[model samples]
Target chain A: MSDNPQNKVKIEARDVQVFYGEAQALHGIDLDLNANEVTALIGPSGCGKSTFLRCINRMNDVIDGCRVAGTITIDGQDVYSPEIDVVELRARVGMVFQKPNPFPKSIYDNVAYGPRIHGLAQSREQLDHIVESSLKRAGLWAEVRDRLSASGTSLSGGQQQRLCIARAIAVSPDVVLMDEPCSALDPIATAVIEELMEELRKDYTIVIVTHSMQQAARISQRTAYFHLGNVVEHGATQQIFTNPKNQQTEAYISGKIG
Target chain B: MTEPSNPSARKAQLAKRYRAERRFRAYGIAAISTAGLILFFLMGSILLSSLPAFTQHYVTLDIDITERHVDTQDLANSDWRALARNALRAQFPEVSGRKEKRALGKLLSIGSSDDVRDYVTANPSSLGTSIRLPLTLSDDIDLLLKGVIDRDLPENERVVSNQDLAWLDRLLDEDRISRQFATRIFTNGDSREPELAGLRGALVGSLWTLLVTLLASFPLGVMAAIYLEEIAPKNRLTQIIEVNINNLAAVPSIVFGLLGLAVFINFFGMPRSAPLVGGLVLALMTLPRIIIPTRAAFAAIPPSIREAAMGVGASRLQVIMHHVLPLAMPGILTGTIIGLAQAAGETAPLLMIGMMAFIVDLPTDVTAKATVLPAQIYMWANNPERAFMARTSAGIVVLLSLLLMVNATAIYFRKRFEKRW
Candidate 1:
């Protein structure tokens, strides 16, 4: 693939190893995430794709007996350094989940929670503006604009997933990590999320871990194929899919192996 | 496994399975109805036994409050009993002997003087005027009037003797005998006389004790539960603590009473029979009960909510306070109220802490020596007096009503705030 000025590294991860108790889940993974681009990690179950995505925002810290050892940096600053405040780090690098988890609160409050906690808005009008723009960017404003006071859970599955997206971007984070954000959604809902991601990539760095190879092919500029806790191939999405690659990557894309 | 090759055999097997299912359903109905029947019988008996205690027999007489008997300056020390005795003697002029006169005097309660005093105190202008005052009947005469003593029994077997019966009949014929609501049972405090014994002291003590229990246990229990569920690491120490908590919930309540007696009373020198000490002991007993269910309520919340909050840059405390705690609140409140209800009905620990004492005054504060409802009921049940039997049942009814109200509040809150995740 030809290089462009837009392809600047936003996140640099090197020799990242993850473990649950004594069982290692990821073995020395190296990946570079570009600014303003969607990077998709595609692999079978237990392939360490989701684990690697969580390394960016330190979401795994809450889990017991889970540990990560390596260097993960955003804009050349180490995320795992003792100086990094987790709360602030998370605000800088937000995350969306596999299932739609909206707080049992009004749609407006759900979207405004991020900004309120981080003191991003000085006035109610500014907070409202953030909620509106975030919802619009996620393509849910038209459906939910009139009923922002209604509970976010009252929406349909697809709309709820969109609401979660809006909530994540409400804080204006630099990077958004989504872990199989479409797994619990239907295909139509999944397509809406994919399109939303495509639009989101223009402003924020996006990293998604998905089981769907087609989703990786359609939405991502760079794709990494993982198997058995190891990355088998990493390149431009088109080359990884269409051109010759490693034997394992070939077998996986051909549906002969996972 | 042998496969049924014929449709008829398969149909027969299906019929057999249906019959088994019907039998199982019948067994379930039988079990539930059995429980319902027992509960109905228990409540019915308590209500029936308490019915007579709700009303009392009083004899109204026109007694002249002369200026000579009542010292206008010192009404508190006035000889009001003399007035009641003279009024009774005037009603029965035919009886002249001392033995017969003493027997007639037993018809009125010993506290009848207080009744006259209270009336005179309220109506100071009525001095030197004839006012009709209703005097409380003694417990024996009351039981006789209510037909609980069986008047037809032989003179020796009956509590109301022949002379007492004649005077009571004379009073009844003259329209002096009136059955009124037993307001004294709720108005006055505990007494040696069953008719004068009231539940006010016990009620106040129970309220104070439960207030302390709730204030002491609820926040502590909830915080301990949160720490164990969300903050504590899963290791041998926590595992031991969890196991002990479960074991504490099953320990005999008397053990908690002994601990209170030793620690709060003997070591700390806290007042015995005080609601504060009783409440603290009960709080200790109820802590495990509250914590166990609270932990369960918290555990029932989905992990996704916590993750959602943390993903949005919420701190650990923020994740629990904003998302997990609200979702788990209904369960926590229900557990806490149920534990409190159990604590309200608990008697063993209180008895051990000296709350079974015969307290005559309403507890003024948590530190005052007082007796709770269950302790009062236990003491009344042990009394040999016949009227005390009815009082015990009445006390049980009050305690049961309180428990029902608390449980209803639990249900109401659970229904009101519960959210489907």
Candidate 2:
């Protein structure tokens, strides 16, 4: 491991392995997400990119017979420590899934759910402020401000994703993990989400898993390519796409190997 | 172009297929209608046979109660039986003539003093005042009024004596006895004599029993369902629990009644025929019914919403409370209402729990002797008086109407809360 003192790492996963019953999903993988930067994990289907993302927030715990091993920490705090409160750990490291899964509630309630559950907002006005600021940070307030009480599901696909982003940020999490956040979106919506991620990196550490290499090139500063449950290459996004050091990475970018 | 050579043959084939399809559809319709017809006929027969019970014949009398008739001194001394007898003799006005008084006394109910004593004790101020009391007609008179007493039948086949029928007919013509709508059937309690019985006491008992069943079963069933569906770990134990719940739902309701009899009535030593014990038993029988549907409702909730909540940094408890529970509410309510309906119709379990008790008075509390609607119908069906058949049918109507209301509410709630996602 190279000691880069100037780079402030928010999350570090060391030698992580994941399995679904006897089937190994993610091999020993090591990675770092720096503060105020977008790190994208890009790969083809079944390459365990999404599985690794789920491991960061321990979302894999919900899957039957799925086990994750090795040390994953956020700001030097072991997320899987026995004393760690999963609720609090989730509060600190939030996630956004592939599909825009808004709660079956009004837009306002969907965004305010986290803060209310964590007792972060003392008054209704404070909760409203949190919702507004989160939505604003997600670049959705301008489009949805007039209908905050409308159902979150009433929004367009892209807007629902942004609302989910706003909901994730509402709890003031330090790191935001997204798994194929724009897979279900149209081109215009995908561009909007890509842009939002760029802006979101200024205030939050963002780790995104995407199938679109162009998306990785457009928004990500750092990128990791995985193949067959192993990290093939990881470096600055431009270098990995333009001049990858590994043959597998080069073949993948050249449309030879997925 | 090629088929043009065989247009007639193709047309004939298509016609044959259409005929087969029509026959298939007709069979489906016939099956559905057959089931519906059977249900309709059963209900129709029950209503048709019990219509006569709603009307009753009674003898009305104007009796003068002088200070000497209902002796205030005897009543104050709690000599209730003497006061009741004296009041009965005064109403006849034949006590001066021993033979006439004896005949009048024979015509009066042996238990008439119980009514007098109840009335006098309830209103002590009316001891010396004149009052009009409508005494219930004898069971024989009631049967004759209902046309059940066939005087032309052979003596062995006839249950009511010819003398009594003749007496009743003469009294009816004299206007001393008359047929009136039996409103008391809706206001009085059960009795050994079906002619004197009503559904008022049973209705109250059923209402109280259902109240307890609802209060106990709904929250507990819903909570257990939510936990099992949304929170509980997927393991052998949970699997066992799920299987047991499904099995319990299919268990014969009478088995639950037997269980109640053994555990609640016998082992617990709870008051026999009390709504409290009955409600507790019914709630147990209803729990599996409620829980299965509620869990299914919760399970119908897509995992995407749960993931969304967790992705938003909300805890599992928060996800369930804020999102899962609300979405599942409609199903939960539908299940609960259906369970209540099932419990309402259940007679076997209630019979096992002593709801067949011969309660002669309206229950004042949950612990008092009571009879539910089904049990009341059962009792009325066995009455020797023919008039009770009508009352039983009327009771069945009330029971069916209540079941319909509950089912309608379930459908309404299911429609109202149905979610697309």
Candidate 3:
């Protein structure tokens, strides 16, 4: 694991501005996400945290009036370049949404969806191995191994969330973006996911958008505090929690305001 | 009651609430019963009126063809009708007047001559012999046998003249007349004579028209819906297209008939009364019907599903084909059944397309002259003959039963693969 503060940059955003029709949502923003590190984007609602996460994999393209201006590069290729196919970019940078949205299929098929679409596995045995390893990595294999044929929707909320994680990682993506991945789960389930994120960053560059300050402080290596479409402060997680340079970050930590 | 301070007020409130509930329940039951009774009366009336069309009576007569009547040198050019009439006249020698003989000949169906010719052709060696053959009785005679002519009415009041009535009674007493299941009504096509008509032509025409409609409309409608709902950018042009499609659904169906006439028949030079052309017209009408529901089906899917598929690197087309389309298929099929059923019963469009032509031949292909079931019913309803009225009711029975079957199949599909998730 790259525990050093100076890890190679995996994704770099420069003068990033987003607009929905005529209304600008993000004013020129710059951020660099490091490799094999968990970078948590913590902000209040409608503060452009989720929008920034979406820009990495070009998911904002699906929105009707959404437009992103600036250079956002992954592996030194601008994601918004004319030659960049959004499909392949998304294949490289997978996402886990806030709510667990599993395909209406069996548990085994749910995990196999990514590998099957990407054609990453060559044979049935290879696919089975990938599914097993992905589920094991998501900390769900032992509990669901016997019920692989059961519907993914039939699982409990925590299990379904982990299954989404397993589905995202099944394609062997280099980066994973999670938007409040544990927002819909109980505290116990949140702790379990937080622990899984610690293990996930051993291979994947992870960016998480979270409302929970404690979750960000506990799981992420670096934390950025956002307020009103701007990054108010960013540093090591412990430094941001103990020694805040921004008044909004201090007020948010003290529960004076969101 | 013991614990409450306002016990009387609470009791009165409960009683009023119960009364209101009872009144609501009574209203529901009354409405259901009223609808049920109306349906029962309609079915009973159709059944009572159509019973005769399901059965037919025929006479077993012996006819002789001699060398003078049929030339051996030209067996192909034969007059079986003249021979049948002579043999029948010779059987009843008491009929001396020419008028009485003509009435006796009227007792036989106009198609009876074809029956005789067919019999002669099938058995060539027995051409000169007196062969006993069963020939279709005239519509009046058949109605008389069914007891619809009302024998108790004075002879002048009834359709059958007294002279032929006595002959019919005599034939009945001699056991020369007998009833059989109405195989002819199901086997033959539309006829001026009800006894010679059948549902085969209408059934085949309906099937062919619907096959073409389904083949043409389903994919087109589904693709249009996918493009509009899934892929198209929301702009003024797309908005206009949406409005036009919805407006097309509300436009009176007969307008489509005129459009089809102008575009398909006049401009394209397609044949009238051919199921191929009729189907093309019906397909154009059915496209909006299908697209509306297909779009609704796709709309019902939560956006999360599409995002999930796209998140896995599935292209937009792949996401729709693999995930969205599969989930929406049952609803799409339900809509298709409704569209096809409507096309099955559509008469006005076909009427405008000239599918109302009196077609007696069963179509072997889509281009052959054909009349759909509703058009057949419309033609039968317009006939002056009482026999055709009964056949019209029978045709209604067939059409309703087909609609019921389509609805049942739709329900089966709904129950089979409805994705609960």
Best by lDDT: 1
Rank candidates, DockQ, best first: 1, 3, 2
Q: Candidate 2, B266: how far from true, in Å? A: 4.3
Q: Interface RMSD of the predictions, in order shown?
A: 0.8, 1.4, 0.8
In terms of docking quality, how is candidate 3 classified?
medium
**lDDT digits (tens) for residues B1-421 of candidate 2:** 5454687988987898899999999999999999999999999898777666776666655444455545565654454444444544654443467665454444444334445656776777776676665555655556656676766887667766554455456556757766678776787788776666778898999998998899989989998898888878889999999999999888888888889889987898988888998898899988998999999888888899888877766677777888888898998999999999989888898888789877878888889889899998888888766666777788899899889998999999989988764
* TM-score winner, 2 or 3: 3
**Better by DockQ, candidate 3 or 1:** 1
Q: Rate the local accuracy (lDDT) of all candidates.
A: 0.92, 0.82, 0.89
Q: RMSD per prediction, one decimal?
A: 1.4, 4.5, 3.1
> What residue runs in model 3 are displaced by over 4 Å at the alpha carbon?
A1-3, B1-14, B62-78, B82-93, B113-133
lDDT of 1 at B414: 99
| Cα RMSD for predicted model 3 | 3.1
Candidate 1 CAPRI category: high
Q: Candidate 2's error at A92, in angstroms?
A: 2.0
Tens digit of per-residue lDDT, candidate 1, span B81-200: 888888888888888988888888889998889899999999888898888989999999999999899999999998788878888898999999999999988888899999999999
- In the order shown, the candidates' DockQ scores are 0.81, 0.55, 0.71
* Candidate 3: tens digits of C-alpha lDDT, residues A1-258: 324756888999898999999988888778888998999999889999999999998889999999999899988889999999889989999999999999999999999988898899999999999999999999999999999999999998899999999999998899999999999999999989999999999899999999998888899988888887788888788888888888889999767898
